[model samples]
Each structure stands twice: as structure tokens, then as C-alpha cells.
Target: MAERIQKELKEIEKNPPDFCSAGMVGGDIRRWQATIIGPPGTPFVGGIFKLSLTFPPKYPMKPPEVTFKTKIYHPNIDRNGNICFNILKDDWSPAYTISAVLVSLCSLLSSPNPEDPLEPQIAAVFLKNKVQYEEEARKWTAKFAMS
Candidate 1:
């Protein structure tokens, strides 16, 4: 398991995503810290969001537990940073790599899936009041993710 994780880490280090960067935390290959630059044209643009990925002992067969370490105002992400993405759940497959997951997270920032949101209230605002939602999202990005 460690060998597989190390291989993935090496691959990620060799060819990292333009919008996201990830590294193992300390000596633990199973734990990683990721930083994602918000996609351009999105409310989160200019913000740098942090995330934590915890790989289980049985990885590849199962998806890693991803959580936002930084505060973000998005319908698909709850206040606690729990993500509600299909790939992270039922659609997950062993073929998916860490780099792919990071890229997908950046894509999510650009196009949130309000229909399957983790935060219902945020999703409602996003659906009914897009302008307001953008405003709030931008504000939160500036406050919490711009460090």
C-alpha cells in the first residue's frame, strides 16, 4: 500500500496540476496537504484553498477522504469542508489518481453542482440569487482563502 502511495506521490511531484499542488504531510504517505488555486472567472478566483486528503489503508480500491482545511463558501462544500462530489462518492473508481482528484476539485470551484449541494441554503442562494451568492462567495474567499 505504501509503495502504491509513494508511486502516486512521485507521479504527482513529477507532473503537478497547474491549478493545484499537493505533498505528503511529514513522513505519512497516507496523509497529504493540498493547495488549490481557485479557477479564473469564478468567485473564488485569487483565493488559495487548502485541503487535506487521508488515504485509507486500502487505497485505489477506495477513495481518499478529502476535506477542505480552509473555509470556502460553495454549495458543494459544507461549512466543515465536507465535499459532495460524485467522484468522491459512488462514482469513485481505482483508476482515478490523486492528480485527477485535485484537478476535479479545481473544476468544481469553477462550476459548482448546486443540484447536489452539501449546503442546502447555499445551494438555494446559488440557484435563486446567483449575484448574491457570488458576492458572498467572493467575500468568504477574500476573508478565509486569500492568506
Candidate 2:
């Protein structure tokens, strides 16, 4: 498991996904920290979102637990930073890599899935009024994600 984690870490360092970077949190190879630059032309643009990942003992076989450390205003993400995405849940496959996960997350920021949301109110706003949702999302990005 550690070997796989190390390989993944090296893979990320060598060919990192655009707008994303990740590394071990400390000495523990099982824990990782990642940063994703907000996708261009989106409400999250200019924001830098942080996320933490904890790999299980049987990683690759089981998906890592990932959550936002930086607050983000998105329908798929809750106040507590829990994300609602299929890949992280039942859709997970051992073939997926950390880079793939980060890329997917960036894509999610670019195009949120309001149909399956962790924040229902935010999803409602996104579904009912995109302009209003973008406005609020930009506000939150500026307030919480900007450094």
C-alpha cells in the first residue's frame, strides 16, 4: 500500500494535473494535502481550494476519503466540506489515480452536478437561478477561498 502511495505521489509530482498539486501531509504516507487553482471563467476562478485525503490500509482497492479544507460554495460540497461525487462513492475503481481525482474535482468546480448535491439549498439556487448562484459562489470564493 505504501509503495503504491509513493508511486502515486511521484506520478503526481512528475505529471500533475492542471491547476492541482498534492503531497504527503507529513511523514505519514497515508495522509495527503492538495491544492486546486479554481478553473478559469468559473465563479471559483482565482480561488485556491485546499483538500485533505486519507488513504485506507487497502488503498487502490478502496477509495481515499477526501474533503475540502478550504470552504467552497458549491452545490456538491457541504458547509463541512464533504463532497458529493460518484467517483468518491460507489463509482470508485482501483484504476483511478490521485491525479484523476484532482482533475475530476476541478471539473466538478467548473461544472457542478446540481441534480445530486450535498447542499440542497445551493443546488436549488443553482437550478432555479444560475446568475444568483454564481454571484453567491463568487462571493464565497472571494471570502473563503481567496488568500
Clashes of each: 0, 0
Estimate, for each residue in 24-129, the C-alpha lDDT of model 2 and write its tens digit. 9877999999999999999999999999999999899999999999999999999998999999999999999999999999999999999999999999999999
TM-score of each: 0.98, 0.98
Cα lDDT, all candidates: 0.94, 0.96
> Which regions of candidate 2 fall more than 4 Å away from where they truly are?
none
Off by over 4 Å in 1: none
TM-score of 1: 0.98
- Which is the leading candidate under lDDT? 2
Clashes of 1: 0
Pairs clashing within candidate 2? none
Q: Candidate 2 lDDT (Cα, whole model)? A: 0.96
Give the 10-residue window scoring lowest on summed lDDT in candidate 2.
23-32
lDDT tens readout by residue for model 1, 11-129: 98999998889999998999999999988999999999999999998898999999999999999999999999999899999999999999999999989999998999999999999
